[model samples]
Target: YFFRDPERRPPDLPGAVVAPADGKIIDLSLVEAGPVHDSAARKVSIFMSPFNVHVNRIPVEGVVKALRYSPGKFAAAFQSKASLDNERQYVDFAGPYGRVGCVQIAGWLARRIVCHLRVGQAVHPGERYGMIRFGSRLDLYLPPECDIRVKLNDRVRAGETIVGVLHETK
Candidate 1:
């Protein structure tokens, strides 16, 4: 029962950006420059302990635009740099608001990362789209206008937690 796929309630907050995995929020910061589609962006990192649910969900409603898997070293996922140094897959989506994406980073004990999403497919918030074995992490990258709702060290449930809100001011 480690890979539980609990039925998650759809977020009631307008323009909600839900958590992509069940775990503790490890990092919440604005990326000034990085390889996540653009330069300035808001990022939310969730660390999935071996005991937490492993199923991953889409964070927002959009059309999948890109999917890139990078094979890298096995590192402790709690480190901030693990995002770039660890084996990971980047899944990005294009919607009315802007580009939103998530990364599935493999943990030290993680050997396989499974992503059920394909490029050009339509995705929705809280929808199960991928998974990773053992301890792992999920990082949500949002447009700068997206207001993050979750905080560092906060525990979040995939598909049910409102990690951020995408503003439609553009």
Candidate 2:
């Protein structure tokens, strides 16, 4: 069954929600850990294979605040440097809960990262937002202090797995 199916069974737990892309978790870095503009984020990278699903979904319910499209060389997304050197689309969404960021990276031979939502658009958790036409990677950057539940290289189903618990700051 494909993700984003209207008839799909709903999840039974509470958290930020599952990942939005189909791939293996390649890296999890707790970058700058701390408030909004002053706060840092944890970067989780999912490497998509050509044989995996190419569509993406929203990991949490929120409203799109801004969209930044970066034009760069199309590199193999699984490579260590792809996250830095490849073309990418960065989207920032702010919910009543917190801020969440999504990054779509273009892989070798895959030149497009199509984001179909606009600024101010509201999105539901697990809702289809856009896709990387062929194969690429999706990075979910979360606020620091989030308690993650998934492991590196773990196989995850978009919309069906819980990757983290959106922690409440003390």
Candidate 3:
């Protein structure tokens, strides 16, 4: 069940950003100049249980600028510190709205993260980019111009739910 790939249809509204993973929203916060991103961003975190689909998708259409993987400790997917302390992979993209960062974090049961993205590869929203074995977490660092759609504790489906709508910055 965890390996099944479901068909998803992304919203066509301009600037609409789709959820990258199927999970429950665990966090929504503002952050600045940390790790993969150097500008102000709003992080939308989702915690995936072992029963949920492990596949991950692109949140927006963009060109991958970099991919960074770090070996670290296993932690609970819902913990705030897990984003930093857990083994993870970060994908940085140069999007139409600017920079976007997606971090795939390993939880207690997840040890491997499979990523299909390469530096400079152009990706579209809803496209499968990777997967994490068992349970894990995904964090999307979005620009401040986003109008977020989901609230904390809300459940979202990868490549389908519109997590937010981004607006162009002046």
How close is each model in CA RMSD to the real structure?
1.3, 3.1, 1.2
- The sequence of per-residue lDDT tens digits that candidate 3 reaches over residues 1-170 is 76888888888977778999999999999987645567778999999999888899999887999999999999888899999899999999777777778999999889889999999999899999999988699999888778999999999999999999887545
Model 1 misplaced stretches (Cα beyond 4 Å): none
Sort the candidates on TM-score, descending order: 3, 1, 2
Candidate 2: residue 63 lDDT (0-100): 90
The top-ranked prediction according to TM-score is 3
Considering every candidate listed, which one attains the maximal lDDT? 3
Task: Give the per-residue lDDT digits (tens) of candidate 1, residues 19-98.
Answer: 99999998888888545556798888999999998999888888999899999988888888889999999998888768
Q: What TM-score number comes out for model 1?
A: 0.95
Lowest lDDT 10-residue stretch of candidate 2: 1-10
RMSD of 1: 1.3
Model 3 CA lDDT for position 49 = 93
Per-residue alpha-carbon lDDT of model 2 for 1-170, expressed as tens digits? 22233423326655565688877999888767311224688788898887778888888777998898889888789886887788989888777557878889998967878899899999887888888877789888887766788889998767767778785434
